[model samples]
Target: MTQAQTLDHTSDQSIEHRIGTAVNQNAAHTREGLLERLFGWFFKGLVYAQIWEDPVADMNALQITEQDDLVCIASGGCNVMSYLMAQPASITAVDLSPAHVALNKLKVAAPRYLDQNAFYDLFGHANKDSNIRALDQHVLPHLDQITRAYWNKATWRGQRKQMFARGLYRHGLLGQFLKFAHALCWAGGVKFDKLLTAQSLDDQNAFFDQEIAPLYDSRFVRFLANRRASLFGLGIPPAQYDKLAADTGGDIIAVLRERTRKLFCDFPIHDNYFAWQAANRGYKSDGTGPVPPYLEAQNFETLRACVDRVEVLNQSVTEMLAAQPEGSKSVYVLLDAQDWMNDDQLNDLWHQITRTARPGARVLFRTGGLTDILPGRVEGAILNHWRYDAEASTRATAEDRSAIYGAVHMYRYEGA
Candidate 1:
């Protein structure tokens, strides 16, 4: 079957089956190591409703234009919506997780139909009671049947719609992980919320120095940081775990401490939503806080106008690109998914990427390690077709406000 046909034929059962297949595929390529297996299992259960990477850095590196057709891995669906503001010709958002596919569809569809306040309440002020009601009245009727079914499915707490009522950010894998981190901080007498009170960069640095940095020194924190399972919260697969350790001289604690410090101290808290989410366990409750670019009121009308340009699919990126016509896409956002792949997988993906990309197409991605993996791993023949923009990549990495990833890499396809 054609790639689009295969994706279109994926019933809800098939999507679940695909998730299982993907987990197995990831595990099978990783030598079936115990930690790899554990990570694969963890990934299968993870529902990433919010993306962690900085989309602003991604867009800056991509230099997206109205003529560019883009394909991105839809994680939390945040960046997919954010990308709409750039007015790309088309955005094909593919994800193996059915939950993410549904969420992305919901995001794209919500803006098209819902009024401003209702849309904000559903996604921005996710803790509010009206979110579920808004989802029902304004959003559900507009979604495709599969997406609607996915959202309406029951969870342990209640229907998935109730997730917004309970606070959408508190439900996903990353969200729950942050919640656990906050719980740990509270137990240890460190108030993560206090980091939000810092009025300046120096104050933020001092807050981290006095309150957050010391938490990493505790035996309990050190022990947790050392465990592979502990990092599943951050969506670190077993392979990425090894890369992170190797990059940090096997000192995961030190690496995490440094990254956490950068997150808190390097950016102004007023505009760094990532730090706010990490510290406060959600976006600022007042709705005036820093948020994803799409959620900002200024971009709402533009995003709403561009909603129809996006397509959400439950499929793999390689498959989606393989199905496209040559020179079909100009921008690719891999979002650290490459770190999970073996060399063969990477080569296969790059092969399809090169085939589908137009000349001057820009590819943006992050890595668990500071070094470039593509140079040695992807076949030289395929790698030669793309020029790695090392200087731009370095600038993008340094400017990335999220400050969690080890490096951000960008490449420009030079054509056949």
Candidate 2:
């Protein structure tokens, strides 16, 4: 290649790396920026083994049609894969985290390459002796080189994909954070077995009040919750952390306790895979509990047939949207990533969302606090093009089974 061509390629790579860095390192010399960097460092690798956002809530809000095209942040890839059951025209999944992008590719590729039982064993059962063979024989060869390298690369324990043979859901940064939370509970002279294993809603609530809720009031727990780094495992950056604390009158522990209560008592244990995952590390081994749509036995054929319509990318959402033609995308799933963006970043994102969005396109996102974030932050010109649906947003938020988020927002583009 010529010298100019090589320089141009190198510069483009540099720009790619810088895309999301500013969101985390905006206040680099300040204490807030330091916490951001710490969270960024911890978040550089695999964070969520499963996306926390509820795909059910997403599909409901999006109201996707076969003519619709989607762009979403592929955290655990669950949302993208599950959306296939709806049979959208295509999905363009992007993530700033390389680890998450790799995970997304592997997830969709496995369904295309592996049979029902093998795919279930690998992801549904999530810890099986046969997964290694399944990966080697069926899934690995079909994945992109980056995805193959990611799963096959050596980690301290072994190759990354071997996690499926062990407890795949119990190894990511979120998983380790959960492990730490459990340990903290043990140290605090309380255990969650009573709360998590309870058979009835009344029993769960009683256990939470009698044993779990009081644990948050302790000085040790309060001190840790106050630290911005403590909730990093939940992928809550320092910026979101501040917002959550502010919303709760500086009582992060109180807010956490409330969310935890909702996760346990709001839904029955047999029905909520999220609660099972939070308390038990993996889904119910007996296959009686619920799971993501893509992980369901009934949806297996649908996924196998439609997995090719999905594409995974390790790029910022704004950057990806900027490259798309105007009015091309119909649905946008921002997740809760906007909780980390500053005013400028939020403006940039809305600009692209408006540019790439069709007149009737829908945008859905979750927030750490109970408010639509775009109102005052995003510039008027860009934000004005979109119309917020308060009624639909409220109904969808209530329907959301995943109790982690404080609010869910939906908006429709009205065009210029």
Candidate 3:
């Protein structure tokens, strides 16, 4: 062959090789991005939408006092009981979930009426035998026939009187949702096993960014973007999904990435057990480090002392606020509840907050994104008087992992 022809042939082969490499890289990036999106979609659908209860953050954020009468959205009743540990005068707990109502009732009665040792064994330890014993000995006898029957009816494959028997402590809808997501992670080639074994925050963060972030960038998550019905399991109705998606610009990945990055990065992973629950279905059996406040040894006595102050109600904030006397409550905690409301509901709730405000009443809640709740929803006349400490809210959120709330806000009503 001629020398010029040989040179041209070699150059052509090099160009083809470069083109193939570029094509391969692009394909890998697209494939990875699609899977990450799927993880976000299904994760949001089955987990956050259906059965998440942010008890740890909610209780820890507000310093409840014996003199304080409080109102809260009692999603699962865990936080209400936790707050009662603070010895609040009264906790008017409300929820739209009937299932949640039944669950909360059990919690309220368990601590108030159960023997201290039994209560500790049942909830503090969350042992199956002790849970059943406590239910039979204390809780069952005190609950109304209606609620009692409800608990008696719901049974798992291996358990009877399911609410009374507590083996599946982490097998709620939320737990199952996480389990499913974890399985998906394995299937997607992102190894998350280290999360279970991470000895330090640095290890946890590295595992999350290196292993989990890639999972967020997958195809399965992108597919989830279109399936609203599948998300009902996560307790997100169609309407809320539209709003959440719209608010986050239809990219649930970015929303989750930003919010969860704070949880994984800002605090010591050990200190934030809720984050552990989020990443790993349950906490490590041996208490090598900090546990949830409700599970902490020191706080059990406090929890026992004032368990009766919390009463769970199956109603909306408007209904509960209406039922309470004006100035009856000194504190109001609404955790991401506003995300579920429309404009009218928002206005009505704030009006109740205004009327229910004692001289120095305070209100705390979370928002889906970083915006303050008052600006568009509550009237300026009422909103302007109350103080909005954005910095304090940011600080509180940074410290709390169960706080998926883009904003953890507090408003104090300094009414004359």
Candidate 4:
């Protein structure tokens, strides 16, 4: 090769070093002992209960356009399907879990094919007979083998296929974990029935002072708070668990109560379904409202067709970036995935993102800290190209429901 060719190859290697490939990636957490892995999975079952991440908020922050081709992580497939509402050109949903992939596929295929009423009945009135009927008559036959097995064959407590057989919407690994917490609180004499009854600000404040406050000061809640394994259900990592726990510093229940209070006090309880699921274990019945297309009224066909335009795979953001056709994609929705990354991962992910970004392409993600993700973590070369919307990010942070994250950020990839 000539001198010019050698210089070109050297520069390519440098770029790869800065934006590492998937081959350089490791599991987000190092390989833990078998017991740790088991515990982590168990915690994942609990903490991930009911997809705690806010899809509606994500949609709003992303401001997706129909011309955009979206690549995103499929946590529960909620956001992926929801993204379709924006009429994006295409969506690629990737997940690490087979179960998540299966769930996303079912969501994409089932809703569009089933009757709109049946679609709402299934996802909206979840855990009801109408939902069960919809599943049996319209959805069951259509589900892929893995999803069908997840519904009809997976056994827990010898109750095989109960999530579907019993119309249990909140009974997935996450849902069951939540129910476990409820059982724990009930057994420990924390009256959840009374705690959930705050009709107004006055009622909420009174309940907080009279009943919930006492529980926050309780011995049981404190014990539960210390068990790092107990919080795994919420998808908190070991490091994050330390931060979350330390954020309390002393009284776990009080700190926890304050965090939960944001969902109730700042935002209307009725509007934040995440709060509803946390407080009430389910959303109020109107059925179609506030849900993705699959769960919307008279919109199942739109959702089914929309699903066809979406592809769900088990891959990381870096891997997605590597395989993307150059200049083919116009948007990337990270969705707080970066909050889970260490600096190395963040740098590599951004490197690939910059390479694939088309002019004016937008990138949006949420963070756990008040400052944006760019300052300390993102390198100078890529950071220089992207303009940070500090004002917008700040405004969004004050309104964020996931109290732990610092801010939600949006950026457009500008050329060097």
**Candidate 2: pairs in clash:** none
Residues 1-416, candidate 2, lDDT per residue (tens digit)?
99767864775465445544645656678988778777776666889989998898788877888998999999998899999989999999998777888888889888877888888888889898799988988888888766787789998899998889898888889999989987877787766677557789998888778877888888888888888888889889988987787778877887788788888888777778888888778888877678998999999998999998998987789889999998899999999989888888888888889888887899999999888888888888888888999988997787777789888999999888
Clashing pairs in 1: 49-76
- Between prediction 1 and prediction 4, the one with superior TM-score is 1
Question: Candidate 3's C-alpha lDDT?
Answer: 0.63
Order the numbered candidates by TM-score, best leading: 2, 1, 4, 3
Stretches of candidate 3 off by over 4 Å are 1-61, 112-121, 124-130, 154-160, 163-169, 230-233, 239-248, 287-290
Model 3 Cα shift for residue 318 (angstroms): 0.8
Estimate candidate 2's alpha-carbon lDDT, on a 0 to 1 scale: 0.84
Off by over 4 Å in 1: 1-32
What TM-score, computed on C-alpha atoms, does each candidate reach? 0.93, 0.94, 0.79, 0.80
Number of clashing residue pairs in every model?
A: 1, 0, 19, 12
How does each model score on lDDT?
A: 0.84, 0.84, 0.63, 0.62
lDDT winner between 2 and 4, please give it.
2
Please rank every candidate by lDDT, starting with the best.
2, 1, 3, 4
**Candidate 4 lowest-lDDT run of ten:** 16-25
Query: What digit string (tens of lDDT, one per residue) describes model 4 on residues 284-386?
Result: 5555224443355555555666677898875677877888776777778776667556788788888888888777777777754334656778888777878
Winner on lDDT between 1 and 3 is: 1
Candidate 2 stretches with Cα past 4 Å from truth are 1-16, 19-22, 188-197
